[model samples]
Target chain A: AQSVTQPDIHITVSEGASLELRCNYSYGATPYLFWYVQSPGQGLQLLLKYFSGDTLVQGIKGFEAEFKRSQSSFNLRKPSVHWSDAAEYFCAVAADNDMRFGAGTRLTVKP
Target chain B: EAGVAQSPRYKIIEKRQSVAFWCNPISGHATLYWYQQILGQGPKLLIQFQNNGVVDDSQLPKDRFSAERLKGVDSTLKIQPAKLEDSAVYLCASSLEPSPYNEQFFGPGTRLTVL
Candidate 1:
């Protein structure tokens, strides 16, 4: 069974500071990777995804992720995070025609 | 294109009560998914349907949860004799296909509160 792991339960960062959320997957093969963001009481919005090709993939909202097959990781990064970027971030992996999600990391932006 | 649609943004029911949630996928989408998101946890896949047929439902608790997508467009999920643990947000998502190339779009979700 494929599963995702997000080590950070909650992260507080100063606004306009760089941000990096760690994500690791447990899978036998290279599975499809995805990052999603969810605001309070709102639906999830796709941040980005990695299937193959380039290891570094760019996503919406000035975010990007680098997929490292060696480590089985796809960590999301943002050079500068805004206050609006504070939300719950989830990492997911898909294999065997199925998908599984991580526990999610709660981001807090401090002014 | 419109995104996935889910109804009953909020529901409150007592133990042993029954509740149902409706979801309407985007037009032309062949794949639909239902997820259960407990507070402070990631969304868990409950079931998946491809064109009115079940593709994967291993995680769904069939003993009390039942879902159907008739005609391959809209879907409904029912939970009879609900339990407190069942209280969570039910999210509906749809994509053109199950392939990774097609991104899945999600709905606002129905928040279920079991009292």
Candidate 2:
């Protein structure tokens, strides 16, 4: 069973500030990783995914995540976050066809 | 392309009552999934269907929960006697295949309140 851990329960950043949300997973082998965002009253939307190839995966809304095998971490990053980036972000890991999600990190953008 | 569709955006019911949610996946998707998301938590998968066949229902509470996909296209999830703990958002998602790499499109979700 694979599990995802998002240490940050909430993150606050100013508009146009750099942001990073840490995500760590516990898996024996290389597992499929993903980042998803959910706005208020909206469903979760896929941000990016890492299966086998690239270490750094780019996603929509000017966000990206880097998969570090040695650290068992896949942290999401954004150079300059916008006001619209305020939402809940979830990290998920899948292995043996079963997927698990983290508790999620809530992002708050300050004006 | 149109995203996944779920009916009754919101519902309110008392404990021990029954509630059912309807979902219609994308036109060409072969995999449909139902997930429960409690307040302040991430979405947890309840059941997964692969073209009308049950692929996974391990996390679903079988005692009072039941789900079915009659035609492999549309699905319905029912709770015989809903509990207060069952209050949450039920989300429907679909993907082109059953693989994890396949991107899933999600529906707006149905918010259920059990008082």
- Candidate 1 per-residue C-alpha lDDT over A4-110 given as tens digits, one digit per residue, 9 for 90 to 100: 99999999999999999999999988999999999988889999999989999999999999999999999999999899999999999988778889999999999
Q: Any runs in candidate 2 off by more than 4 Å, and if so which? A: none
lDDT of 2 at B4: 92
lDDT of 2 at B78: 97
Model 2 complex DockQ against the native: 0.86
Per-model TM-score, in order, reads: 0.98, 0.98
**Candidate 2 lDDT by residue in tens digits, A1-111:** 788999999999999999999999999999999999999989999999998787999999899999999999999999999999999999999988788899999999999
What does the lDDT read for residue A16 in candidate 2?
93
What's the residue-level lDDT of B47 in candidate 2? 98
**Per-residue lDDT tens digits of candidate 1, residues B63-108?**
9999999999999999998999999999999999987778989999
Question: Which residue pairs show collisions in model 1?
Answer: none
What are the iRMS values of all candidates? 0.8, 0.8
